[model samples]
Target: MSENKNYQHPDVQKAENDELEIDWMEILRKIIAIRKTLYKAAGVGMVLGIIIALSIPKQYTVTVTLSPEMNGDKASGGLASLASSFLGGGTSSNNDALNVTLAPDIVSSTPFVLDLFDTRVQTLDGKLDTTLVSYLDEQKQPWWGYVKAAPSLAIGAIKSLLTEEADSTAALNPFQLTEKEATKVKGLRQAITANVEKKTAMTTITVTLQDPKVAAIVADSVVAKLQQYIVDYRIKKAKEDCAYLEELYKERQQEYYDAQSKYAHYFDTNRNIAFQSIRAEQERLQNDMSLAYQVYSQVAQQLQVARAKIQEEKPVFAVVEPATIPLYPSGISRKIILIGIIFLTICITGGWKLFGYSYWLKIKKMI
Candidate 1:
């Protein structure tokens, strides 16, 4: 009796079965019906991909790696310690100011980027030999870019006609950059990059440009400048100390010479004088000369120590990988672009046909 109650009507059972079962054949039929549209989409995608690939310029990337000496002070031990004892145990704290983490910001700074404007660059093909600024000003661009920029260029031209012409020959002030210079600075910043690894303190500088040789040259320049910057910062105080000590040494040396001359003259003039007063005066001059000589000698030693400290405080940088011209262009190739476009086209077309069209039909019927 329970089985008979659960059986219900045959029509109701058939409707429930239809709700639970998927119509795989119907989905396939719908996909096949739109196969022609999918083919047209793929064809259009291929054409567009080719055009984009041809319009984009090839870029070469050059990279340089450096290992900076991170130890606080190389001269803190050995002879430096002895010098410190004599110099009142004054050690330089400038080492703490050496922060490799700021390398990225340093590279992107307006001053640093603008300084590269006059840097001479030669292309691999020997067709271009000009400063970075000139090369950038005359750089090639996609055809569509010019089309898109026409309006802006026209507006700028009109503005320039109405405004007073600025002096192009004037020196650039980092604190205040002109509109054109600022734009160039922004482009250069994007072209050059510096990264430092925290755990190893390894610095990597990269320069990307259309010209491989120029990229390599710029990368090398960046490495050299960065190393110099770090070295200068690390030994700044030491250099100042050395310069001060040199001046003090000169003063003490002059006093010693003057005291020695007086002592010699007094001794020679009173050589035959037998008066007790004369003997006392000669002794006093001798004591003065001795004191001056002692002071001068101590200053001379300190000056030498300071000079050594300059050498000691200087940080050493080991170039792990020097900049080299890149052979292959970076970024996606034309083949990859074509394949990607075709793949995306098929996915979109298939998704729309399978779900989007059906949803649209339902909405239209409801409306």
Candidate 2:
């Protein structure tokens, strides 16, 4: 009775400090035991990774690097064709990435992507390819594309997918686009990447294909086609520049003629005192000639630049390191994945041990 009273009395009660002590050796033994039990799951995971790594088809990447033409006046014949137009416009075209930012509302608009269908590729024979007729077939989406989890569903969908794969070629034309050619354009648009280096004339482009040869061909073709596009675009601009400069040059010439004509009339009228006022008149003529010369020099420089651009014969793409087929899979990081699996296994085993401990305590209470 007295012992029981002492245990219940607040004054006699002793406070117990709670502490947890882990036995490292025991924990290690438990972990080893857990691994032995889970050895089958671990083996299954490793096998699955190896199989997945090998099952994926190899894809090759092809790339081209270009040093874009600078907006400079080097008096080169190739650039002279555009100098006038560029000067008139007061600015250059919005760069590749900047196109989206320039018109954000229309960048992702459906009309824009659909409008791409209107552009067609013309072959050397000047006829549209029949391959463009099946453009709508590209819209066939992968099954379970939106459903991320349960990849098996997507695989099942892909097997029976009613999709047409686009065959892109160098002959593809941008002007003769039709409904049939829309799919090819869409596919091309997606597979292509264009990036320009900041504050420099460097541009990089990449294209991917299942066949290594096709990848290389597509990359080279894009480089060729794009050069033509730039040259034509430049030529048109140069003509405009030439026209503007011609008009400005005429205006300056008229002013120069009027200045000369005025000085002549004054000299004839003041012939009696021509020698007396000759110094003042000479100073005035010098100032006018200097101003006229400055304007003529500036306009002449612009005209020369435009002429140079029209004569560019070849596209200039400085090839850095061209892309090659990747030897290792870039999709999966095996070491990182294995480490994650090991961590999860440890958590699950720890939970199981806790569950068993609680069950044993309950059984002892019953006994």
C-alpha lDDT score of every prediction, in listed order: 0.84, 0.52
Query: Which residue pairs overlap in candidate 1's backbone?
Result: none
lDDT string, candidate 2, 1-367, tens digits: 7767545544333322111123555567676776665665556556654554444444556667776545543333334335645554232332232221122233223343334333332322333232222322322333343355347556656755766544554344556554345545556566556666666656676765444544555566556556555555545655676678778877877776777677667667666775746858865875776677677767666656545544542234455755444344333365665655655655655656646767878999999
Cα RMSD of all models vs. native, in order, equals 3.3, 12.7
Clashes of each: 0, 28
TM-score of model number 1: 0.87
Model 1: lDDT equals: 0.84
Q: Candidate 1 at 101: error in angstroms?
A: 2.5
Candidate 2 has its poorest 10 consecutive residues by lDDT at 95-104
**Candidate 2 Cα lDDT to native:** 0.52
**Per-model TM-score versus the true fold:** 0.87, 0.44
- Determine which window of 10 residues in candidate 1 has minimal summed lDDT: 89-98
